[model samples]
Structure formats: structure tokens, C-alpha cells
Target: MNSLLKCRYCGWVGGKSDFEWDHMDPKIKTESFLLDFLQGKLELICSGCNRQKSDKTSQDYTFWRWLFPRQANFGPIRAHTFMDTLLQRIHREIR
Candidate 1:
């Protein structure tokens, strides 16, 4: 039987076909290109969640929404870590 993976951002769990790889730490402006590139910094996430995450490194949800202006409303059905980050951001915004 094929093993199932759970998304750290969203609580989605299913077969390999149901998920996409998300780079927790984007390789855009890292100091060591080769090291970062070769490292296993990927996490399994739903395709829908991947779209919202894009290349953003920040775990902040509002920032995520802002990053993908066109898909502001689009996001994981239930992102556990993302929601935690969102709650943190909310408090920061309030202050």
C-alpha cells in the first residue's frame, strides 16, 4: 500500500497524488545556493495550499494572502500551522 503524507501547513492527508511539495524556506535569496538547493526543505501540502504558499517563506497568513493578490480567498481548507501563524499576525496587526 502507498504511504500517505500529512501537510504541516494544512491538515490534509491522502495519497501522493493529493499533495504537492512546498519549500518551507524558499531558495530565492539564500546565502548558500547549493546547500539550500540540495537540502530537504520541502513539505507535503495540498495543491490548493501550495498555490497560496507560492515562494513565500513567511508563515504569516495575511502576508500570504497579500503575496497572492489574485488568489487572496484561495487557501487550505484547514491549515493548522497557518492558522496559528494567522492568529499571531492578527495580534501583531492589532498592536
Candidate 2:
């Protein structure tokens, strides 16, 4: 059997050695993680992104923007509604 790690948000599969073992906030997880994120309670952040994001926001990477873009013309749903869609996508693809 092959061992691989995949990013829950983007589905980027990586080797075990290259992956970080982490989980969503214990109180949130996938089913409730989205709610936490939108309510300013949860952060589905990646380790690599720690250097960039803090309490407010960051522009260096694409994850935050992709998930919660200020401009709403492109994403399939608005930031508020997309939180659910994003979580659904993560569950369907990675969980």
C-alpha cells in the first residue's frame, strides 16, 4: 500500500514525509469548520501560510482569496455562502 497525505482544501497529495499531520479545530472539524471560518471563529489555515496570515488577512497567497475573495464576481458563491460549499468540497474530495 502507498502512503500519501492530501490537503483537505486543495487536494494536493503529498508523500508522508512531506506532509504535516494536523486536524481542524477540535470544536469544528469539517461538518462545523465552515461555520467557524465564516463566523470569524475558525481558520482552515495551512502551515505554509502561517508566515503570511495573522489576525487580519494576507495577500501573498491565494487560499484566503480563493475561499473568501473581497470581490465576488468570480467565485461560484459569495464568501458567506461559499464557506459551506468549500467545506462540502473538502469533504467530498479529501475526507
Candidate 3:
């Protein structure tokens, strides 16, 4: 499956040799690794991007996108959705 996949986070297009499978929600932080894997929360990313993203949750990436605006593939529409989700999560926590 060489070059058949693209990095979802960094948009890197390359062969399988350069790609790495990263768990978007991070298996280490989640309750069950098997559950996370079975839930389809994994993504293919380039080695460099995998290192840079490094177990950061989607919320973390959302914040990083706000600060850097050039780190990954968080576009405007996606950013709006992400921020909305983030706000909802925060509101729930505060309540």
C-alpha cells in the first residue's frame, strides 16, 4: 500500500515507508487502547508530523492551530467546528 494513504494531520503524501500510524486521541491517555483502535480513531501521518503532533489531542491541536495558524491542516471551517466542540466541552466541564 505504498503511497496509497495521506497524512490526515499534515497532508503529507508519500510511500508507506515514510508514514506512521498515530492515534488521534492517544491510546496512552484513553481508557482502552483496543476501544480506541476499534473506534477508528487512528490516522496515517508522516514520521515528522507524527513526532510534531506527538500524542496531542484534537483540542490541543485546535489550540496550537490558533497560536501558530500554520502547524497542520486546521482550515477555517474545520477550525470553527473545532472551536465549537471545544466550547461545548468546556461548558460541560464548568457546569
Scored by TM-score, the top model is 3
* Superposed Cα deviation of residue 49, candidate 2 (Å): 5.4
List model 3 lDDT by residue over 1-95, tens digit each.
33456666556666676676678777454676667677787766677666767778756865775688665542112345768999999999999
Once model 1 is optimally superposed onto the true structure by TM-score, how far is the C-alpha of residue 64 displaced, in angstroms? Answer: 5.1
The lDDT for every candidate, in the order shown, is: 0.65, 0.44, 0.66
Indicate the worst ten consecutive residues by lDDT in candidate 1: 70-79
Candidate RMSDs in Å, in order, are: 13.4, 17.3, 14.5
Model 3 Cα shift for residue 44 (angstroms): 1.1
Steric collisions counted per model? 0, 1, 0
Q: Give the Å error, residue 17, model 1.
A: 0.4
TM-score of 2: 0.29
Off by over 4 Å in 3: 1-3, 27-35, 69-95
The segments of candidate 1 whose C-alpha lies over 4 angstroms from its true place after superposition are 27-37, 61-95
Instruction: For model 3, give the RMSD to the true fold.
Output: 14.5
Ten-residue region with minimum lDDT total, candidate 3: 71-80
Please provide, for model 2 over 1-95, each residue's C-alpha lDDT reduced to its tens digit, 9 standing for 90 to 100. Answer: 88765544444454553333233333334565456566665433333332233333333234564876553122111345668888899999985
